[model samples]
Target: MPTKPPLIHVLHPGLFTTVQDLGRCGYQRFGVSVSGAMDPWALLVGNRLLGNPDRAAALEITLHGPELLFEQALTIALTGADLSPTTNGFAIPMWTVVAMQAGSRLQFGTRRQGARAYLTVAGGITGPMMLGSLSTHVRSGLGGLAGRAVKKWDQFCVGPAPRTAAQSIGRSLLERYRPRYTKSPTVRVMPGPQSDYFTDDAVQLLTSSSYRVTTESDRMGYRLEGAELPHRASAEIVSEAVCVGSLQVPSNRQPILLMADCQPTGGYAKLATMISADRSLAAQLAPGDSLSFRMISAQQASELFRSHHAELDRILPPCCS
Candidate 1:
Protein backbone atom coordinates (compact mmCIF):
# COMPACT_ATOMS: atom_id res chain seq x y z
CA MET A 1 0.00 0.00 0.00
CA PRO A 2 1.14 3.55 -0.69
CA THR A 3 2.08 5.88 2.15
CA LYS A 4 -0.44 8.61 2.80
CA PRO A 5 0.34 12.25 1.98
CA PRO A 6 1.10 14.84 4.67
CA LEU A 7 -0.89 18.03 5.38
CA ILE A 8 0.19 21.64 5.86
CA HIS A 9 -1.75 24.11 7.90
CA VAL A 10 -1.80 27.73 6.90
CA LEU A 11 -1.20 29.83 9.98
CA HIS A 12 -1.46 33.07 8.04
CA PRO A 13 -2.05 33.73 4.38
CA GLY A 14 0.42 36.11 2.79
CA LEU A 15 -0.60 38.80 0.34
CA PHE A 16 -1.71 37.23 -2.96
CA THR A 17 -0.36 33.74 -2.33
CA THR A 18 -1.85 31.24 -4.82
CA VAL A 19 -1.36 27.73 -6.12
CA GLN A 20 0.08 27.51 -9.67
CA ASP A 21 1.20 24.99 -12.21
CA LEU A 22 2.80 25.57 -15.63
CA GLY A 23 -0.46 26.99 -17.11
CA ARG A 24 -3.53 26.09 -19.14
CA CYS A 25 -2.98 25.38 -22.81
CA GLY A 26 -5.25 25.10 -25.90
CA TYR A 27 -8.12 26.92 -24.22
CA GLN A 28 -7.05 30.47 -24.95
CA ARG A 29 -9.12 30.46 -28.14
CA PHE A 30 -12.20 30.30 -25.99
CA GLY A 31 -11.04 33.30 -23.92
CA VAL A 32 -8.89 31.97 -21.08
CA SER A 33 -5.62 33.31 -19.75
CA VAL A 34 -2.51 31.25 -19.24
CA SER A 35 -2.43 32.12 -15.61
CA GLY A 36 0.46 30.36 -13.94
CA ALA A 37 3.72 30.99 -12.12
CA MET A 38 5.07 34.36 -13.18
CA ASP A 39 8.58 33.10 -12.75
CA PRO A 40 8.29 29.62 -14.14
CA TRP A 41 12.03 29.04 -14.13
CA ALA A 42 12.13 29.53 -10.38
CA LEU A 43 9.10 27.31 -9.86
CA LEU A 44 10.65 24.58 -11.99
CA VAL A 45 13.89 24.79 -10.05
CA GLY A 46 12.10 24.37 -6.74
CA ASN A 47 10.16 21.42 -8.09
CA ARG A 48 13.27 19.81 -9.55
CA LEU A 49 15.11 20.15 -6.24
CA LEU A 50 12.32 18.24 -4.54
CA GLY A 51 12.21 15.55 -7.28
CA ASN A 52 8.76 16.64 -8.43
CA PRO A 53 7.50 16.82 -11.98
CA ASP A 54 8.30 20.01 -13.88
CA ARG A 55 4.65 21.09 -13.95
CA ALA A 56 3.91 20.13 -10.36
CA ALA A 57 1.77 22.68 -8.53
CA ALA A 58 3.57 24.99 -6.10
CA LEU A 59 2.68 28.00 -4.01
CA GLU A 60 3.44 31.27 -5.81
CA ILE A 61 4.11 33.68 -3.00
CA THR A 62 3.85 37.15 -4.45
CA LEU A 63 5.61 40.11 -2.90
CA HIS A 64 4.69 38.80 0.57
CA GLY A 65 4.72 35.28 1.98
CA PRO A 66 2.66 33.13 4.29
CA GLU A 67 3.34 31.27 7.52
CA LEU A 68 2.84 27.53 7.30
CA LEU A 69 2.73 24.81 9.94
CA PHE A 70 3.58 21.31 8.91
CA GLU A 71 1.56 18.53 10.53
CA GLN A 72 4.13 15.88 9.67
CA ALA A 73 7.75 15.73 8.66
CA LEU A 74 8.27 16.54 4.98
CA THR A 75 10.96 17.64 2.55
CA ILE A 76 10.49 20.84 0.54
CA ALA A 77 12.34 23.43 -1.50
CA LEU A 78 12.21 27.21 -1.94
CA THR A 79 13.21 29.26 -4.96
CA GLY A 80 12.76 32.56 -6.78
CA ALA A 81 12.64 35.78 -4.74
CA ASP A 82 14.68 35.85 -1.57
CA LEU A 83 11.78 36.57 0.72
CA SER A 84 13.87 35.81 3.79
CA PRO A 85 12.22 32.46 4.39
CA THR A 86 12.49 31.19 7.93
CA THR A 87 11.60 28.11 9.92
CA ASN A 88 10.88 28.58 13.62
CA GLY A 89 12.54 32.00 13.49
CA PHE A 90 15.69 30.69 11.77
CA ALA A 91 16.51 31.61 8.19
CA ILE A 92 16.43 28.86 5.61
CA PRO A 93 18.33 28.91 2.32
CA MET A 94 16.55 29.12 -1.03
CA TRP A 95 17.21 26.98 -4.14
CA THR A 96 17.91 23.86 -2.08
CA VAL A 97 16.17 20.89 -0.53
CA VAL A 98 15.13 21.42 3.08
CA ALA A 99 13.77 18.86 5.50
CA MET A 100 11.15 20.01 7.97
CA GLN A 101 10.15 18.25 11.17
CA ALA A 102 6.58 17.75 12.26
CA GLY A 103 5.09 20.90 13.80
CA SER A 104 7.78 23.06 12.17
CA ARG A 105 6.68 26.57 11.38
CA LEU A 106 7.81 28.00 8.03
CA GLN A 107 7.52 31.75 7.67
CA PHE A 108 8.74 34.54 5.45
CA GLY A 109 9.82 38.09 6.23
CA THR A 110 11.43 41.02 4.46
CA ARG A 111 11.96 40.44 0.76
CA ARG A 112 15.60 40.46 -0.14
CA GLN A 113 15.13 40.33 -3.93
CA GLY A 114 12.65 39.70 -6.77
CA ALA A 115 8.88 40.01 -6.77
CA ARG A 116 7.73 36.44 -6.16
CA ALA A 117 8.86 33.19 -4.47
CA TYR A 118 7.94 29.54 -4.95
CA LEU A 119 7.58 26.78 -2.36
CA THR A 120 7.53 23.20 -3.57
CA VAL A 121 7.05 19.95 -1.69
CA ALA A 122 8.27 16.47 -2.60
CA GLY A 123 4.97 15.55 -4.23
CA GLY A 124 3.89 19.11 -5.07
CA ILE A 125 0.77 20.84 -3.68
CA THR A 126 -2.44 19.06 -4.50
CA GLY A 127 -5.22 21.22 -6.01
CA PRO A 128 -8.24 21.01 -8.28
CA MET A 129 -7.29 21.04 -11.96
CA MET A 130 -9.26 23.24 -14.36
CA LEU A 131 -8.59 23.42 -18.07
CA GLY A 132 -5.80 20.86 -17.59
CA SER A 133 -3.94 23.04 -15.09
CA LEU A 134 -4.05 23.90 -11.40
CA SER A 135 -3.19 27.57 -11.91
CA THR A 136 -5.21 30.15 -10.02
CA HIS A 137 -6.76 33.03 -11.98
CA VAL A 138 -8.35 35.24 -9.34
CA ARG A 139 -10.70 37.17 -11.60
CA SER A 140 -11.98 34.05 -13.35
CA GLY A 141 -11.72 31.96 -10.20
CA LEU A 142 -10.97 28.89 -12.29
CA GLY A 143 -8.38 26.94 -10.30
CA GLY A 144 -6.49 26.70 -7.02
CA LEU A 145 -7.93 27.13 -3.49
CA ALA A 146 -11.37 27.33 -5.10
CA GLY A 147 -10.13 29.78 -7.76
CA ARG A 148 -8.62 32.26 -5.31
CA ALA A 149 -5.66 32.93 -3.10
CA VAL A 150 -4.97 30.90 -0.01
CA LYS A 151 -6.73 32.18 3.08
CA LYS A 152 -5.95 32.17 6.79
CA TRP A 153 -6.47 28.77 8.44
CA ASP A 154 -6.59 27.10 5.04
CA GLN A 155 -5.20 23.56 4.90
CA PHE A 156 -3.27 21.93 2.03
CA CYS A 157 -1.85 18.53 1.27
CA VAL A 158 0.80 17.14 -1.05
CA GLY A 159 0.22 14.37 -3.56
CA PRO A 160 1.33 10.88 -2.75
CA ALA A 161 5.07 10.39 -3.05
CA PRO A 162 6.53 7.32 -4.71
CA ARG A 163 7.83 4.88 -2.12
CA THR A 164 10.79 4.00 -4.34
CA ALA A 165 11.77 7.65 -4.79
CA ALA A 166 15.16 8.62 -3.47
CA GLN A 167 15.48 11.16 -0.71
CA SER A 168 16.98 14.23 -2.44
CA ILE A 169 17.89 15.94 0.80
CA GLY A 170 20.64 18.58 0.90
CA ARG A 171 20.45 19.07 -2.86
CA SER A 172 21.28 22.58 -3.98
CA LEU A 173 20.61 24.16 -7.37
CA LEU A 174 23.62 25.37 -9.27
CA GLU A 175 24.07 29.04 -10.14
CA ARG A 176 24.03 28.51 -13.90
CA TYR A 177 20.40 27.39 -13.94
CA ARG A 178 19.22 30.23 -11.70
CA PRO A 179 18.01 33.47 -13.28
CA ARG A 180 19.55 36.58 -11.77
CA TYR A 181 16.86 39.23 -11.18
CA THR A 182 17.43 42.90 -10.46
CA LYS A 183 15.40 46.05 -9.92
CA SER A 184 16.06 47.21 -13.47
CA PRO A 185 16.34 44.41 -15.98
CA THR A 186 16.71 44.97 -19.72
CA VAL A 187 14.78 42.25 -21.51
CA ARG A 188 15.11 41.32 -25.17
CA VAL A 189 12.15 41.78 -27.48
CA MET A 190 10.93 41.08 -31.01
CA PRO A 191 8.72 43.25 -33.16
CA GLY A 192 5.01 42.67 -32.63
CA PRO A 193 2.46 41.78 -35.29
CA GLN A 194 1.27 45.42 -35.34
CA SER A 195 4.76 46.77 -35.53
CA ASP A 196 3.95 48.42 -38.83
CA TYR A 197 1.16 50.39 -37.20
CA PHE A 198 3.65 52.48 -35.24
CA THR A 199 5.93 55.15 -36.65
CA ASP A 200 9.68 54.73 -36.85
CA ASP A 201 10.10 57.25 -34.03
CA ALA A 202 7.78 55.20 -31.85
CA VAL A 203 9.97 52.17 -32.27
CA GLN A 204 13.08 54.19 -31.50
CA LEU A 205 11.48 55.68 -28.38
CA LEU A 206 10.43 52.26 -27.14
CA THR A 207 13.92 50.81 -27.33
CA SER A 208 15.65 53.93 -26.08
CA SER A 209 13.41 54.83 -23.17
CA SER A 210 13.29 53.32 -19.70
CA TYR A 211 9.91 52.40 -18.23
CA ARG A 212 8.80 52.19 -14.63
CA VAL A 213 6.12 49.68 -13.65
CA THR A 214 3.17 51.47 -12.11
CA THR A 215 1.44 50.27 -8.96
CA GLU A 216 -1.73 49.82 -11.02
CA SER A 217 -0.12 46.77 -12.57
CA ASP A 218 -1.26 43.28 -11.65
CA ARG A 219 -1.14 39.73 -12.97
CA MET A 220 -3.20 40.73 -15.99
CA GLY A 221 -0.66 43.26 -17.30
CA TYR A 222 1.70 46.04 -16.36
CA ARG A 223 0.84 49.66 -16.98
CA LEU A 224 4.27 51.07 -17.73
CA GLU A 225 5.11 54.75 -17.43
CA GLY A 226 7.82 55.80 -19.78
CA ALA A 227 8.55 57.40 -23.15
CA GLU A 228 5.32 57.58 -25.09
CA LEU A 229 5.49 55.63 -28.31
CA PRO A 230 3.33 57.66 -30.66
CA HIS A 231 1.33 55.67 -33.15
CA ARG A 232 1.09 56.48 -36.87
CA ALA A 233 -2.51 57.48 -36.40
CA SER A 234 -4.67 55.65 -33.84
CA ALA A 235 -3.88 53.19 -31.04
CA GLU A 236 -6.84 50.94 -31.59
CA ILE A 237 -6.56 47.82 -33.67
CA VAL A 238 -8.71 44.83 -34.36
CA SER A 239 -8.91 42.56 -31.35
CA GLU A 240 -6.33 39.87 -31.96
CA ALA A 241 -4.33 37.24 -30.22
CA VAL A 242 -2.03 38.46 -27.51
CA CYS A 243 0.26 36.46 -25.28
CA VAL A 244 2.25 37.01 -22.13
CA GLY A 245 5.07 39.56 -22.56
CA SER A 246 3.22 41.55 -25.21
CA LEU A 247 4.22 45.23 -25.14
CA GLN A 248 1.08 47.01 -26.25
CA VAL A 249 1.05 50.76 -26.68
CA PRO A 250 -2.28 52.54 -26.33
CA SER A 251 -3.24 56.15 -27.09
CA ASN A 252 -1.51 57.20 -23.91
CA ARG A 253 1.75 56.02 -25.55
CA GLN A 254 3.07 54.30 -22.43
CA PRO A 255 3.71 50.63 -23.05
CA ILE A 256 1.66 47.93 -21.33
CA LEU A 257 3.59 44.77 -20.64
CA LEU A 258 1.14 41.91 -20.69
CA MET A 259 1.77 39.22 -18.12
CA ALA A 260 0.20 36.13 -16.66
CA ASP A 261 -3.63 36.33 -16.61
CA CYS A 262 -3.61 38.78 -19.54
CA GLN A 263 -6.62 38.55 -21.82
CA PRO A 264 -6.34 36.12 -24.73
CA THR A 265 -7.01 38.93 -27.20
CA GLY A 266 -6.33 42.66 -27.17
CA GLY A 267 -7.13 45.62 -29.40
CA TYR A 268 -4.26 47.99 -28.70
CA ALA A 269 -1.40 48.16 -31.14
CA LYS A 270 1.56 46.16 -29.83
CA LEU A 271 5.02 47.45 -30.58
CA ALA A 272 6.97 44.44 -29.42
CA THR A 273 6.92 41.25 -27.41
CA MET A 274 9.58 40.35 -24.89
CA ILE A 275 11.44 37.23 -25.94
CA SER A 276 10.89 34.01 -24.05
CA ALA A 277 14.47 34.02 -22.75
CA ASP A 278 13.97 37.29 -20.85
CA ARG A 279 10.33 36.77 -19.77
CA SER A 280 11.57 35.32 -16.47
CA LEU A 281 13.39 38.54 -15.66
CA ALA A 282 10.34 40.60 -16.57
CA ALA A 283 8.23 38.40 -14.32
CA GLN A 284 10.45 39.15 -11.34
CA LEU A 285 10.08 42.90 -11.59
CA ALA A 286 7.75 44.66 -9.17
CA PRO A 287 5.88 47.97 -9.12
CA GLY A 288 8.27 50.95 -9.21
CA ASP A 289 11.02 48.80 -10.72
CA SER A 290 12.32 50.08 -14.07
CA LEU A 291 13.12 48.17 -17.24
CA SER A 292 14.20 48.80 -20.83
CA PHE A 293 13.88 46.87 -24.02
CA ARG A 294 16.50 45.77 -26.52
CA MET A 295 15.24 44.94 -29.97
CA ILE A 296 16.36 41.63 -31.45
CA SER A 297 15.61 39.92 -34.72
CA ALA A 298 13.20 37.02 -34.87
CA GLN A 299 16.04 34.66 -35.68
CA GLN A 300 18.04 35.96 -32.73
CA ALA A 301 15.01 35.54 -30.49
CA SER A 302 14.66 31.90 -31.52
CA GLU A 303 18.33 31.25 -30.87
CA LEU A 304 18.09 32.81 -27.44
CA PHE A 305 15.04 30.71 -26.65
CA ARG A 306 16.84 27.50 -27.69
CA SER A 307 19.82 28.35 -25.52
CA HIS A 308 17.61 29.19 -22.54
CA HIS A 309 15.53 26.05 -22.98
CA ALA A 310 18.70 23.98 -23.00
CA GLU A 311 19.73 25.50 -19.69
CA LEU A 312 16.37 24.69 -18.09
CA ASP A 313 16.59 21.16 -19.43
CA ARG A 314 19.73 20.62 -17.40
CA ILE A 315 18.08 21.64 -14.14
CA LEU A 316 16.68 18.16 -13.59
CA PRO A 317 17.21 14.59 -14.67
CA PRO A 318 15.56 13.32 -17.87
CA CYS A 319 12.98 11.34 -15.93
CA CYS A 320 12.16 14.24 -13.67
CA SER A 321 11.28 16.58 -16.55
Candidate 2:
Protein backbone atom coordinates (compact mmCIF):
# COMPACT_ATOMS: atom_id res chain seq x y z
CA MET A 1 0.00 0.00 0.00
CA PRO A 2 1.26 3.53 -0.84
CA THR A 3 1.71 5.93 2.03
CA LYS A 4 -0.10 9.29 2.12
CA PRO A 5 1.80 12.53 1.80
CA PRO A 6 2.61 14.47 5.00
CA LEU A 7 -0.24 16.69 6.09
CA ILE A 8 -0.91 19.30 8.78
CA HIS A 9 -4.57 19.35 9.64
CA VAL A 10 -5.93 22.46 11.27
CA LEU A 11 -8.30 21.64 14.10
CA HIS A 12 -8.87 25.27 14.99
CA PRO A 13 -7.63 28.39 13.20
CA GLY A 14 -6.31 30.98 15.60
CA LEU A 15 -6.89 34.68 15.49
CA PHE A 16 -5.65 36.29 12.25
CA THR A 17 -3.41 33.42 11.14
CA THR A 18 -1.99 33.57 7.59
CA VAL A 19 0.71 32.14 5.35
CA GLN A 20 3.47 34.66 4.66
CA ASP A 21 6.95 34.77 3.18
CA LEU A 22 9.19 37.86 2.86
CA GLY A 23 6.46 39.46 0.75
CA ARG A 24 5.95 40.17 -2.96
CA CYS A 25 8.60 42.54 -4.26
CA GLY A 26 8.60 44.61 -7.47
CA TYR A 27 4.81 44.57 -7.58
CA GLN A 28 4.31 47.75 -5.60
CA ARG A 29 5.11 49.74 -8.73
CA PHE A 30 1.97 48.28 -10.28
CA GLY A 31 -0.09 49.29 -7.19
CA VAL A 32 0.15 45.82 -5.66
CA SER A 33 0.59 45.81 -1.91
CA VAL A 34 3.55 43.87 -0.56
CA SER A 35 1.64 41.60 1.80
CA GLY A 36 4.15 39.40 3.53
CA ALA A 37 5.04 38.32 7.01
CA MET A 38 4.65 41.14 9.49
CA ASP A 39 7.78 39.94 11.22
CA PRO A 40 9.93 39.01 8.26
CA TRP A 41 12.97 38.60 10.48
CA ALA A 42 11.21 35.85 12.43
CA LEU A 43 10.13 34.13 9.22
CA LEU A 44 13.69 34.24 7.89
CA VAL A 45 15.09 32.96 11.15
CA GLY A 46 12.64 30.06 11.19
CA ASN A 47 13.48 29.18 7.59
CA ARG A 48 17.21 29.43 8.25
CA LEU A 49 16.86 27.09 11.23
CA LEU A 50 15.32 24.51 8.89
CA GLY A 51 17.88 25.09 6.09
CA ASN A 52 15.10 26.32 3.83
CA PRO A 53 15.43 29.35 1.57
CA ASP A 54 15.31 32.67 3.43
CA ARG A 55 11.86 33.42 1.98
CA ALA A 56 10.15 30.04 2.05
CA ALA A 57 6.51 30.12 3.07
CA ALA A 58 5.67 29.53 6.73
CA LEU A 59 2.68 29.73 9.03
CA GLU A 60 2.35 33.20 10.60
CA ILE A 61 0.39 32.51 13.76
CA THR A 62 -1.09 35.53 15.43
CA LEU A 63 -2.34 36.48 18.92
CA HIS A 64 -4.38 33.34 19.62
CA GLY A 65 -2.42 30.43 18.19
CA PRO A 66 -3.94 27.53 16.27
CA GLU A 67 -4.53 23.85 17.08
CA LEU A 68 -3.00 21.46 14.57
CA LEU A 69 -2.67 17.67 14.21
CA PHE A 70 0.24 16.21 12.34
CA GLU A 71 -0.39 13.16 10.21
CA GLN A 72 3.29 12.31 9.60
CA ALA A 73 6.63 12.58 11.35
CA LEU A 74 8.40 15.91 10.81
CA THR A 75 10.89 18.43 12.13
CA ILE A 76 9.87 21.99 12.93
CA ALA A 77 11.06 25.30 14.29
CA LEU A 78 9.08 27.97 16.15
CA THR A 79 10.17 31.59 16.20
CA GLY A 80 8.93 35.11 16.93
CA ALA A 81 6.23 35.56 19.62
CA ASP A 82 6.10 33.12 22.51
CA LEU A 83 2.56 31.87 22.33
CA SER A 84 3.34 28.95 24.60
CA PRO A 85 3.59 26.18 22.03
CA THR A 86 2.87 22.60 22.98
CA THR A 87 3.13 19.28 21.18
CA ASN A 88 1.12 16.30 22.41
CA GLY A 89 0.13 18.54 25.34
CA PHE A 90 3.76 18.99 26.40
CA ALA A 91 5.48 22.39 26.41
CA ILE A 92 8.00 23.12 23.65
CA PRO A 93 10.56 25.90 23.57
CA MET A 94 10.85 28.48 20.87
CA TRP A 95 13.98 29.30 18.79
CA THR A 96 14.87 25.62 18.68
CA VAL A 97 14.18 22.80 16.24
CA VAL A 98 12.26 19.73 17.45
CA ALA A 99 11.15 16.48 15.92
CA MET A 100 7.56 15.33 16.33
CA GLN A 101 5.98 11.93 15.85
CA ALA A 102 3.12 11.20 13.53
CA GLY A 103 -0.33 11.76 15.11
CA SER A 104 1.10 14.29 17.55
CA ARG A 105 -1.06 17.31 18.26
CA LEU A 106 0.30 20.87 18.32
CA GLN A 107 -1.40 23.60 20.30
CA PHE A 108 -0.81 27.02 21.79
CA GLY A 109 -1.97 28.35 25.11
CA THR A 110 -2.66 31.90 26.29
CA ARG A 111 -0.23 34.43 24.86
CA ARG A 112 2.36 34.81 27.61
CA GLN A 113 4.17 37.47 25.58
CA GLY A 114 4.50 38.79 22.02
CA ALA A 115 1.82 38.98 19.32
CA ARG A 116 3.06 36.86 16.41
CA ALA A 117 4.82 33.51 15.91
CA TYR A 118 6.30 31.74 12.88
CA LEU A 119 6.25 27.96 12.52
CA THR A 120 8.53 26.47 9.87
CA VAL A 121 8.66 22.79 9.04
CA ALA A 122 11.78 20.91 7.91
CA GLY A 123 10.44 21.39 4.41
CA GLY A 124 8.65 24.56 3.42
CA ILE A 125 4.87 24.92 3.17
CA THR A 126 3.76 23.79 -0.28
CA GLY A 127 1.57 26.53 -1.76
CA PRO A 128 1.11 28.65 -4.90
CA MET A 129 2.83 31.99 -4.96
CA MET A 130 1.21 35.04 -6.46
CA LEU A 131 3.56 37.68 -7.80
CA GLY A 132 6.53 35.54 -6.74
CA SER A 133 5.46 35.34 -3.10
CA LEU A 134 3.29 32.99 -1.07
CA SER A 135 2.13 35.82 1.18
CA THR A 136 -1.60 36.18 1.68
CA HIS A 137 -3.15 39.61 1.14
CA VAL A 138 -6.49 39.01 2.84
CA ARG A 139 -8.13 42.15 1.53
CA SER A 140 -7.44 41.41 -2.13
CA GLY A 141 -7.51 37.60 -1.93
CA LEU A 142 -4.04 37.15 -3.45
CA GLY A 143 -2.01 34.12 -2.30
CA GLY A 144 -1.72 31.46 0.42
CA LEU A 145 -4.46 28.83 0.71
CA ALA A 146 -6.86 30.56 -1.64
CA GLY A 147 -5.98 33.96 -0.18
CA ARG A 148 -7.62 33.25 3.16
CA ALA A 149 -6.70 32.20 6.66
CA VAL A 150 -6.49 28.46 7.27
CA LYS A 151 -9.74 27.23 8.77
CA LYS A 152 -10.93 24.19 10.69
CA TRP A 153 -10.46 20.92 8.77
CA ASP A 154 -7.99 22.61 6.38
CA GLN A 155 -5.23 20.21 5.40
CA PHE A 156 -1.83 21.58 4.29
CA CYS A 157 0.70 19.50 2.37
CA VAL A 158 4.20 20.00 3.74
CA GLY A 159 7.30 19.60 1.58
CA PRO A 160 9.91 16.86 1.94
CA ALA A 161 12.24 16.88 4.96
CA PRO A 162 15.74 18.37 4.86
CA ARG A 163 17.69 16.86 1.96
CA THR A 164 20.92 17.17 3.95
CA ALA A 165 22.49 14.02 5.29
CA ALA A 166 23.38 15.60 8.62
CA GLN A 167 20.45 17.55 10.04
CA SER A 168 20.87 19.93 12.97
CA ILE A 169 18.21 18.72 15.35
CA GLY A 170 17.60 20.48 18.70
CA ARG A 171 19.62 23.48 17.46
CA SER A 172 18.90 26.73 19.29
CA LEU A 173 19.63 30.42 18.78
CA LEU A 174 22.00 32.35 21.00
CA GLU A 175 20.78 34.67 23.75
CA ARG A 176 21.30 37.83 21.74
CA TYR A 177 19.31 36.50 18.75
CA ARG A 178 16.35 35.46 20.91
CA PRO A 179 13.46 37.93 20.68
CA ARG A 180 12.35 40.00 23.67
CA TYR A 181 8.66 40.71 24.11
CA THR A 182 7.89 43.64 26.39
CA LYS A 183 4.95 45.88 27.18
CA SER A 184 6.93 48.95 26.21
CA PRO A 185 9.15 48.52 23.16
CA THR A 186 11.32 51.38 21.92
CA VAL A 187 11.23 51.46 18.14
CA ARG A 188 13.78 53.30 16.01
CA VAL A 189 12.77 55.70 13.26
CA MET A 190 14.20 57.88 10.48
CA PRO A 191 12.77 61.00 8.93
CA GLY A 192 10.36 60.25 6.11
CA PRO A 193 10.08 61.93 2.70
CA GLN A 194 7.49 64.38 4.06
CA SER A 195 9.09 65.07 7.39
CA ASP A 196 9.19 68.80 6.76
CA TYR A 197 5.40 69.08 6.54
CA PHE A 198 5.07 68.51 10.26
CA THR A 199 5.85 71.24 12.77
CA ASP A 200 8.87 70.85 14.97
CA ASP A 201 6.52 70.22 17.87
CA ALA A 202 4.98 67.28 16.05
CA VAL A 203 8.37 65.70 15.49
CA GLN A 204 9.36 66.32 19.07
CA LEU A 205 6.12 64.87 20.36
CA LEU A 206 6.65 61.79 18.24
CA THR A 207 10.04 61.13 19.76
CA SER A 208 9.32 62.27 23.28
CA SER A 209 5.90 60.88 24.11
CA SER A 210 4.70 57.32 24.46
CA TYR A 211 1.95 56.04 22.17
CA ARG A 212 -0.47 53.19 22.75
CA VAL A 213 -1.25 50.77 19.95
CA THR A 214 -4.99 50.96 19.27
CA THR A 215 -7.47 48.17 18.63
CA GLU A 216 -7.85 49.43 15.06
CA SER A 217 -4.38 48.19 14.24
CA ASP A 218 -3.89 45.40 11.69
CA ARG A 219 -1.45 44.27 9.00
CA MET A 220 -2.23 47.38 7.02
CA GLY A 221 -1.07 49.76 9.75
CA TYR A 222 -0.92 50.40 13.51
CA ARG A 223 -3.16 53.26 14.54
CA LEU A 224 -1.73 55.06 17.55
CA GLU A 225 -3.44 57.25 20.08
CA GLY A 226 -1.41 59.82 21.95
CA ALA A 227 -0.29 63.43 21.65
CA GLU A 228 -1.69 64.90 18.46
CA LEU A 229 0.97 65.84 15.94
CA PRO A 230 -0.20 68.99 14.25
CA HIS A 231 1.03 69.77 10.78
CA ARG A 232 2.79 73.03 9.83
CA ALA A 233 0.96 73.22 6.49
CA SER A 234 -1.93 71.41 4.85
CA ALA A 235 -2.06 67.76 5.89
CA GLU A 236 -2.59 66.62 2.32
CA ILE A 237 0.38 65.40 0.31
CA VAL A 238 0.61 64.28 -3.28
CA SER A 239 -0.41 60.63 -3.71
CA GLU A 240 3.09 59.26 -3.46
CA ALA A 241 4.60 55.84 -3.07
CA VAL A 242 4.40 54.63 0.50
CA CYS A 243 6.49 51.97 2.12
CA VAL A 244 5.99 49.76 5.12
CA GLY A 245 6.73 51.69 8.35
CA SER A 246 5.62 55.02 6.92
CA LEU A 247 4.25 57.13 9.82
CA GLN A 248 1.35 58.79 8.04
CA VAL A 249 -0.54 61.58 9.81
CA PRO A 250 -3.91 62.60 8.53
CA SER A 251 -5.86 65.78 9.38
CA ASN A 252 -6.75 64.40 12.80
CA ARG A 253 -3.05 64.41 13.81
CA GLN A 254 -2.91 60.81 15.08
CA PRO A 255 -0.17 58.87 13.33
CA ILE A 256 -0.86 55.70 11.40
CA LEU A 257 2.17 53.47 11.31
CA LEU A 258 1.78 51.54 8.08
CA MET A 259 2.72 47.87 7.99
CA ALA A 260 3.18 44.96 5.54
CA ASP A 261 -0.28 45.16 3.95
CA CYS A 262 -0.35 48.94 3.44
CA GLN A 263 -1.34 50.41 0.11
CA PRO A 264 1.31 50.98 -2.53
CA THR A 265 0.67 54.74 -2.47
CA GLY A 266 -0.81 57.10 0.11
CA GLY A 267 -1.70 60.78 0.30
CA TYR A 268 -1.10 61.58 3.96
CA ALA A 269 1.90 63.44 5.33
CA LYS A 270 4.53 60.99 6.52
CA LEU A 271 6.61 62.37 9.33
CA ALA A 272 9.00 59.47 9.76
CA THR A 273 9.49 55.80 9.06
CA MET A 274 10.24 53.12 11.59
CA ILE A 275 13.68 51.69 10.83
CA SER A 276 13.86 48.20 9.34
CA ALA A 277 15.73 46.79 12.32
CA ASP A 278 12.86 47.67 14.66
CA ARG A 279 9.87 46.97 12.42
CA SER A 280 10.06 43.27 13.17
CA LEU A 281 10.05 44.06 16.86
CA ALA A 282 7.19 46.43 16.31
CA ALA A 283 5.31 43.66 14.54
CA GLN A 284 5.27 41.74 17.80
CA LEU A 285 3.55 44.58 19.61
CA ALA A 286 -0.14 44.15 20.40
CA PRO A 287 -3.03 46.48 21.16
CA GLY A 288 -2.56 48.55 24.31
CA ASP A 289 1.19 48.01 24.16
CA SER A 290 3.13 51.12 25.10
CA LEU A 291 5.35 52.11 22.18
CA SER A 292 7.98 54.83 21.94
CA PHE A 293 10.39 55.88 19.19
CA ARG A 294 14.02 57.00 19.01
CA MET A 295 15.28 58.89 16.00
CA ILE A 296 18.46 57.73 14.33
CA SER A 297 20.65 59.16 11.60
CA ALA A 298 20.38 57.79 8.06
CA GLN A 299 23.87 56.32 8.31
CA GLN A 300 23.04 54.67 11.61
CA ALA A 301 19.87 53.12 10.15
CA SER A 302 21.82 51.74 7.18
CA GLU A 303 24.43 50.22 9.44
CA LEU A 304 21.78 48.59 11.64
CA PHE A 305 20.15 46.89 8.66
CA ARG A 306 23.49 45.60 7.37
CA SER A 307 24.53 44.45 10.83
CA HIS A 308 21.28 42.56 11.42
CA HIS A 309 21.63 40.54 8.20
CA ALA A 310 25.31 39.90 8.96
CA GLU A 311 24.42 38.55 12.38
CA LEU A 312 21.75 36.27 10.89
CA ASP A 313 24.27 34.95 8.37
CA ARG A 314 26.60 34.05 11.20
CA ILE A 315 23.99 32.11 13.19
CA LEU A 316 22.04 30.47 10.35
CA PRO A 317 22.40 26.69 10.03
CA PRO A 318 24.46 25.41 7.11
CA CYS A 319 22.49 24.75 3.91
CA CYS A 320 23.91 21.29 3.23
CA SER A 321 21.16 20.27 0.84
Instruction: Please count the clashing residue pairs in each candidate, in the order shown.
Output: 0, 0
Off by over 4 Å in 1: 1-4, 162-166, 318-321
TM-score for candidate 1, please give it. 0.96
User: Please, what are the lDDT tens digits per residue for candidate 2 over residues 183-218?
Assistant: 789999988888899888777899899999999999
Stretches > 4 Å off in candidate 2: 1-4, 317-321
Q: What TM-score against the true fold does each predicted structure earn?
A: 0.96, 0.96
In angstroms, give how far residue 12 of model 2 lies from its true place. Answer: 0.5
Q: lDDT of all the models against the reference?
A: 0.87, 0.88
lDDT score at residue 72, model 1, on the 0-100 scale: 86
Worst ten in a row by lDDT for model 2 = 159-168
Question: Residue 297 CA error for candidate 2 (Å)?
Answer: 1.3
For model 1, residues 89-128, the per-residue Cα lDDT tens digits are: 8899889888899999999998788989999888889977
